[model samples]
Target: MSTEQPQSGDPTGMAGPVTDDARLFPPLQGRAVPVAQDRWERLVSAVDIPQPPEAVWAALTDPGRVAHWFGVCRGNWARADCEVMLDFEDGEFFWCRIQQNSAPTADHPGRLRYLWRWVGIGPVTSVTWTVAASEGGTSVTVVEEAVNPPSDWRSWNGMGWPGILDQLAAHLRTGTTWRWPWRRMGPYLQVPLPAPPFQAWEALTAPGAVRHWLQPCAGSLAVDDEMTVVMGDASGCALLKVTRLVDSGQEFPSYLPYLEFELRRPRWPAPLAGRIWIEPVGLHESLLQVFQSGWEGVGIPAAVVERRILTGYWTSAAARAQMLLRPPGAQAPPIGPHGWSLSGGDDG
Candidate 1:
C-alpha cells in the first residue's frame, strides 16, 4: 500500500489537511462502507499469548507492570479510579480512566474496561480488553468504542491499537514493549467562554426563556418535575432530561442534562460528567462554562455533535446576550463566521 498521506478539509485541529488514506480499512473484503448514521463503530484486535492466564492477568491487572508495555499509569489498583497516560511514538498522548473491572473467571480468565480522553479534548472514548487461556497459550482481545472522534482519529487509532496489543502480548511472553516510530499531529481549535453569575436563575428555568435558547428539532421535554428534551432525525434523536439542579451546592445543573443525554445513547457514550457554572466577568457579561467527564460508545462520534453544538450555542448565546444588554436601537454584531452582515449604505 502507498504511504503517501491523504488530504481532507481540516477538522480535528491536526496540522495539514486530512486524507482518506488515514482512515481504517474495511475488515472484510468487498464490505460496504460504514455510514456515519450507524452512530457507533467497533474495532477488535486480538493477539496470541505464550504465557499462562495467571501471568497474562498479572501483567494486565498490575498498573505498574502494564505501564511498561502500554503507557504511564497512575492510580491505586485497590481503587477503580486510576488514570492512564498513553504516549505514542509520535509524541501524541491519550488519557484514560478505568471504569470497569471483572475478576478472572473459569471461562474468561481476565477482563478490563477503560474510558479514554484525549488530554485536551472534551469527550471521552472507551476500550475493553479481554484475555482467555487457550491451548498452550492465552488469547487477548481489545475492543474500542469511539464517540464523535475527528474522522482521521479513527484510522490513526485503528493502526495504533494493533501495535499496542502486540506489545502487550510480547510483554506477557518476553516482558517488554518494543519501541516504534511515531509523529505528533497539530493542535486543535479552542473555544473560550466568559465567567458566569449569569442573569437570573429564571432565564434557564422559565419555559419561555428555555424555548428562546433551546434549538427546535423533532423532540419534546417530558418528565415529572425535571424536563426531558428529545431531538434528532430518523436514525436516532438524543433524549436529555434534567434530573437535578443546584447551583454552588456541590452539584451543577449541566450534569443533569449531560447524564440524561448520554443514557439515551447507550451505544455511543460520553466519558465524563461535569458541573455547569455561570460566572460574571464584566458588569453585564457572564460566561457559561460546562466541564464534562469523557465517555465512549459505538456509533456516530460525540465529537462531531459536540463541535456542531458548541458552534451553534456560542453563536446563539452571543446574539441573545447582546439583545439582553444592548440599547434598544443598537443591533447585535454578526455572531459567527457565516452570519449575515449589513453595509454602511443607508436605506433609500
Candidate 2:
C-alpha cells in the first residue's frame, strides 16, 4: 500500500516538524528488558490478524507465501532440523536452523522457532513466531532475543516490530504487501581537506561560505534554529532544522565537533537527518565527513531514483567544497563513492 501523502505547494518545499499526529502506524509497543540477569535482551510485539489460524500458519510456513511478505524462505519446514536461508535481497542472506515447528492442534496453537544468524557469524539468536486463535481470528506474536543488545535496541528493533506487524495485517486483510526489500539508503562520504579542521568546519557551518560549494543558504545555523537552502536560480527551497551544533572546544572537548540537521521537504515521506563533522588528520590536514540517512521513503522505483539524485547532489556538493579548499595545481583525487568530483546534481 502506498504511504505517500498528497503534496501541497511546490514539490520541493518546506516541511513541518514530525509529530505523533502524522505518524502512519500506531504507538509502538514492545520491551527490551534483559532476560536472565542481563545476559540476553528480548524484543516482542503482537498483532491480531483478521484471518484464521490455518491461513496465518500457511503464511508463516509456506516458502512462496513467506517471500510475499517477509524474506525469501528456501527450505522445507516439514523436514526435521531443516536449514533455511532467508534472503531479503539486501546483499546479505540470513541462515536459520529450525529448532521447533509445532503445528496447530485441536487444543493448542502452533509455534515456529528458529536459530537465526548471518552466515559465518557467531552468537546466533533465537526467533519465534506464534499463532493462536483469538476472539476474531488469530493473534500472531513475534519474539526475537539476543545477547549484547545495542544502545538503541529499544527504539530501533523493539518499536520496529509494530510496523512490521502492521504490514503483516495489511497483507492478510487485502492481499497487498509493501514494496519488496525496502532497502535502507544512507549515503556516507569523506573528503580529504587541505585546511585544518576548524576551517573545514567553517566551510560547512557558515552560511556564506556554504554558498560557494552547496546551494545559497542563509540562516543562523545555531542549535534549534532553521535554515533555508535555496535551489538553483531560487527555483525552490527546503528547510533544515539544526538539531545539534557541537563545538570541539565545548564541555565535551574529546568529542568531534559536528552539526546535525533535520532536512524537511513537502513531499518527503519523512524528514531526513544529516550531519557534517570534521576529523583532524595532522597539523594542517583534516577529513570532512558527510552522512545522511532516512532515504527509504516507501515509494520504490520513484524513491530509488530520488535517492540516487539526492546522493549525487551531496557527493557533488562535497567535491565542490573540497575544490574550494584545495591549493592550485593539486591533482584531483580518485573518483568513487568516497572521493571528490565536480559533477553537479540537483537536490531538494
Candidate 3:
C-alpha cells in the first residue's frame, strides 16, 4: 500500500542484528495511557521483561527479532534520516523517517525516534521507543505523540499497545510469535477521489447519496444523530451515532471537513469508532482519510473472522463510492482488477 517509489540502493535493506545467544525473558503485564499536555497528545505504553538490557535492546533493534512481535521492518537504522518501512501484514504498511537512533549509554537508556507518516494522508506523528534496565530485567516503553489528533485518537492508537507489548514479551520469552489479533490501532486507509471536496463529502454523508454506496440509513448525518443502518442481509439493525462534525471553512478553511462516528452491531463486542477527513487535492480532486479501531477484545481467531467480514463490506462500499464520484466516461485511476480492498484486507 506504500505509494512511494523504491529506494535507490539495497532493495532488501540491511539484515537485522544478530547475537549468538537469544535469551528468554519471563513475561509480565504492560500498561498504556494517553497523555495530553499543551498542544500535543501522546500514547505511552511500557512493559517489563525478565531479561537483561542488552538482550531487550537487541530484540528492539534487530529486524528479525522485531518481526516476531511487531511487523516486517525494512530499514538501515545506523544513522538519522533513514527511511524505514514497517509492514503489518494484512495491508497495514507504514513508511517513516528515523529522526534519532541512540544506543544505550552508561548514563541513559537506548532510545529511538521516528516521524510516522502514511504516504501523504493523515497527520504526521512522532514515535519513540526506549529501553532501560528495570529492577530485575529490562523495561521497554513506546510513546506516540501528535498535535491536534482526531477525536478517537487514543482508542485508535492506544488500544493495541498492550497486546503488542504482550507479543513482544512472548517473543522474548518463548521464541515463537503469534499474530496480533487487532488491526485498527492506527489509520485504516486513505484513497484518492475523482471528485471535488463538495461532491465527495455529499456522497459520503448525504442520506440519499450514501445509500447508493454505503448501507441505507434512517436519519441525517447531523451531530448527535443516532441513525439506524439497514444491513445488506437485513439480519439485524446497525446503529450509528455522530459524535463530532467539522466543516472545512468553519474552523480550518484550507483543511477538509472531519466527521467522527460510533457504529454498533448486534453481534459486536464493542462499537466500532471511525473518523473521516476529506482533503481537497485540487479543485476537481480530493483525498479521503479514514481511521477506525475497536471490537477486538474477543481473542485472535474471532477477531480474524470479524476482520474478514468487515474487509469485504468496506471494500465494496469504497468501490461503489468511487463509481458514484467518477465523472461520466472518465476513468479513475486503476485500483486493481480484483477490486479496491483496504490495504490490510486479504484481497488487497
Candidate 4:
C-alpha cells in the first residue's frame, strides 16, 4: 500500500529527455575509447540502520514513497529501459534510464543494482543498493559507477554522495524523507593566486616546516623525483599522506590542481585521493584549493571536513608568514580577501 514507486519501471510519469548541452562537456580525449577491457570502476556508499531489511526493501521498491525521500517520482515504475525522473522542489530534475536490476540471492538478500543513464550524458552510471540484516538492524550500501565522466562531474559526484546517503539513512530511521538543499562546499571556496609565484612560496616544502604546519602528530615526509611531497600522519589519523606538490608557475586551471596520495589509514571516510592547488598572492601570502574524490569507508562527510581543514591551513599559513617577517610585539594584520597580509617587520 506504500505510495513509493516500484523498483521496476512504470509508464504513467514518463517524459521526454531533458538535454542541456551546456552542462555536458565534450568527452575528454581517449574517454570514449574504453580505457581497458576489464575496467570495472565502482564507487560505494553505505549507512547503518536499526531497521529490518524488509522495511528498507519496501522503501526501495515503492515509487511514491521513494519520491518522498529522494524527490518526485515520475514515469512507469515497473519495467527496465524506462525513463525515471527525479524532480526536485527547486524545479530541477535529472533523467535516468534503468539498465539492470538484480534481486537478492543466496549470498545476498535485499540487494539491487541498476544502471542509470542520464539524459544527454555520454556514459551510463551504475548504482547498486545492498541491504544486509545485522545483529541490530540492516546495513544499506549504495555504489555508483560512472564511465569516463569529466573532471567536474567526478568532483561534484564525489562530494555529493555523503549528503545523499545521510538523507537515505534518516529516511530509513524515521520513515520520513530528507533533502539536501544547499550548495556544494567546493564551489563556495574561492582561492585566487598565480601558479608560479605560489610555487616559489613553498616554505612548507621543508620536512621540518611541513611537520610543523601540516602534520601536528608524528609522520614522515619524502619528496619524489617529480618534486611531490609525500607525508604520513599519526596512527588512525583521517588525513592521508600528502603526495604531490606543484609550482604555482605552471599554467594550470584557476581551480584546485589534481593531487595524488597514498592512504595508510582505512577508517578515513570517502575522498581517498584527488588534487590540491596552492597559489601565492605575495612573497609570504598564498591561497589553498583542494579537489579530492573517492572514499575508503563510509560515514562522516569528507568534503565538509576538507573545506574546514583547508581554511585552517590558509589561516595558519598567513600567521606563519607574519611571524617570519615581523619582530616581537608587532601585531599581525588581517588577512585580505585575496589571502595577503602585511609583510613588514615590527620595530618594537
Model 1 C-alpha lDDT per residue in residues 49-166, reported as the tens digit of each score: 8888778888878767766886555444413577656543222245567777776677656778887654323245678888888888888888888643433446756654788777
- Regions of candidate 4 where Cα sits further than 4 Å from its true position: 1-41, 102-107, 119-122, 182-250, 253-348
TM-score of each: 0.41, 0.45, 0.50, 0.40
Residue-level lDDT tens digits of model 4 in 1-348:
768563345464333232355347665666554223223356677778787777777777678767867767677542466766655533234455665455544367665655553311224567777778877887878888764333354465674366676776788777675566443322112232322333424544555655443433555544232222212222123345657654444544664333455433343444345455444333333444444344323244554444333333333433443344344576755645333222121101
What are the per-model C-alpha RMSD values against the true structure? 25.2, 23.4, 21.6, 24.6
Please estimate how well model 4 matches the true structure, expressed as its whole-model Cα lDDT.
0.48
In model 2, the runs with Cα more than 4 Å from the true position are: 1-39, 77-80, 118-123, 158-160, 177-181, 186-348
Candidate 2 vs. true structure, TM-score: 0.45
In the range 299-341, model 3's lDDT, one tens digit per residue, is 3445554454454455455555666676788865455533323
Ranking 1 against 3 by TM-score, winner: 3
lDDT of 2 by residue, 1-348 (tens): 977765596464335534444665555787465333234578889999888999988877887777777777666653449877775544234568888888776689899999865421323668888889999899999998875433234574546488777767877788875534555645555556777777777666666656556654566677887767643222355577789888866646556688888876556657778887777654466667666777664334466544544555555666677777878888755455322235422121
Better of 1 and 3 by lDDT: 3
Error of 1 at 99 (Å): 1.7
As for TM-score, the candidate ahead, 1 or 4, is: 1
Count: clashes, candidate 4: 33
Q: Pick the candidate with the highest TM-score.
A: 3
Query: What is the C-alpha RMSD, rounded to one decimal, of candidate 2?
Result: 23.4
